[model samples]
Target: MKKYLGEGLLIVFSVLFALFINSLAQKYQTSQKVKVAKESLLKEMEQNQVIMTQWKEKHSKILKHIDEIIKNDSLQEELIKDHFLDIGALTGQENLISSLVTSTAWETAQATQILSELDFDTTQELTYVYELQNSIINSTLPDLVDIYFQRETHRKESLLPTLIQFKLHFNEIVGQETLLVTLYPGAIEKLQD
Candidate 1:
């Protein structure tokens, strides 16, 4: 009877050991999956930040044009509102994007308020272009032009081209800037204006 009792105790210990080993294996697999998911998220965040930085740099180049439009006496308040809206868009601020998408609306509402004081029709395509050009000339369009060209060249040469290049192309037409600046007006001439 003592011998049987000893054998039964050994069997119980073996079963517990097997369960502990299985639990350890499961924990290890779960930890690995978590690490991999974290790495992928970090990579995605880094890539998005890079693209946003590039977009902001490009927006800086075209501020002059935007300013020119804002100052136009003939421009409608509605047109200026749109200009402000687009300008707010270039910043890629989280709060701004959230508000605009989920009931936050752009900080451009301030500009829109100022715009509401004036009365003019902004729907005509030709007038809209002229106002937009004027606003952009005074705004930071030059910076954007430089950034766009830089990225375009980088894309043409690099192998690991990101979807960012395609994203930039999809954004609204701000201005038609050839990748080559020398072929266009010198930056010095723009500053002189």
Candidate 2:
């Protein structure tokens, strides 16, 4: 009976040890995955930051030109007299082009449930940043396109109204871009940590 008892104890201990080892291996694997996800996210954020900064600068410049055109009657007259020929020139480009900000890494992380591994603060900040980015893409870009097309179609009969609309939309977009640009750094820092 004593020998049987010793054999039973040995079997239980072996099973427990195996479970402990398996748990440690699972944890190590999870940590490694989190580390790789963080690195990918950090790189993505850095690239987005650069793109946002560039777009912000471009938008700010365009906004300044729009402000000047709006405030100065002479400039408006010149623009109209020229048949709005310099609209592109005023905007510092032949066409107003928007740069797209990417969120693939963040989306992939979320899809894979990696975001749950992140701390609350990091996840919250990234969510805010990406939400704002999606807002710009979904809301602001379409409005800008509408304004641009409206300006193109009605420049002869409704120049001032289109210009005013453009001003309002551009102002809103620039403000959004500025806020988003400010957010990128903090999110990147959290991921690096």
Candidate 3:
């Protein structure tokens, strides 16, 4: 009877040890997934931040040039009289900024179910940032197309107000993007640590 009891105890211990090893393996796999997801997210965030900063700088410079032109009564009269042909000279053919936002990492993480492994707060913040990016892209499309047509058609007086209005809207979007970029670094660092 004592020998049987000893054999039973050994079997139970072996089973428990196997379960522990399995748990550790599962934990390690999960940690690796989280790390990969975090790295991908960090890369995407950094890229978006850089692109937003560049866009903001370019937009501000263009707006400044436009403001200067509009503030000068003489220039405004010249543009008005000449039908704003010089606006093309000032703004150039490439005035419309293309969207530089990317969502591949986010989409991949979602499709692979890795996003669920990320922290709740991090997921929420990422969602908010992407949503803002999408909004900025969609909102600016019509204005950009309008600017293109205006420039192409040389509709000076009409284009000026439209450009000014678009600039205002662009500034608001840039402000929101800047705020998101500012907040992203800290969150990424925390996750990395």
Q: Which number leads on TM-score? A: 2
Off by over 4 Å in 2: 77-87, 94-98, 151-153
Q: Using Cα atoms with residue i matched to residue i, what is each candidate's TM-score against the true structure?
A: 0.37, 0.88, 0.72
lDDT of each: 0.36, 0.83, 0.70
Candidate 2 residue-wise lDDT, 1-193, digit = tens: 9999999999999999999999999999989989989998899899888988887888788888878887987877776786653557558763455666788999889998989999999999999999999998898978887766654634656766777887888889889989999999999989988
lDDT by residue (tens digit), candidate 3, 76-134: 55645766545444454345465577878888888988888877887877887777777
| Residue ranges of candidate 1 with Cα displaced over 4 Å | 61-64, 73-193
Candidate 1 per-residue lDDT, tens place, 37-103, comes to: 3343334334433433443345444343344333553432433244222323333332211210010
Which stretches of candidate 3 lie above 4 Å from their native place? Answer: 1-16, 73-95, 141-143, 150-157
- Arranged by TM-score with the best first, the candidates are 2, 3, 1
Query: How far off is residue 137 in model 1, in Å?
Result: 27
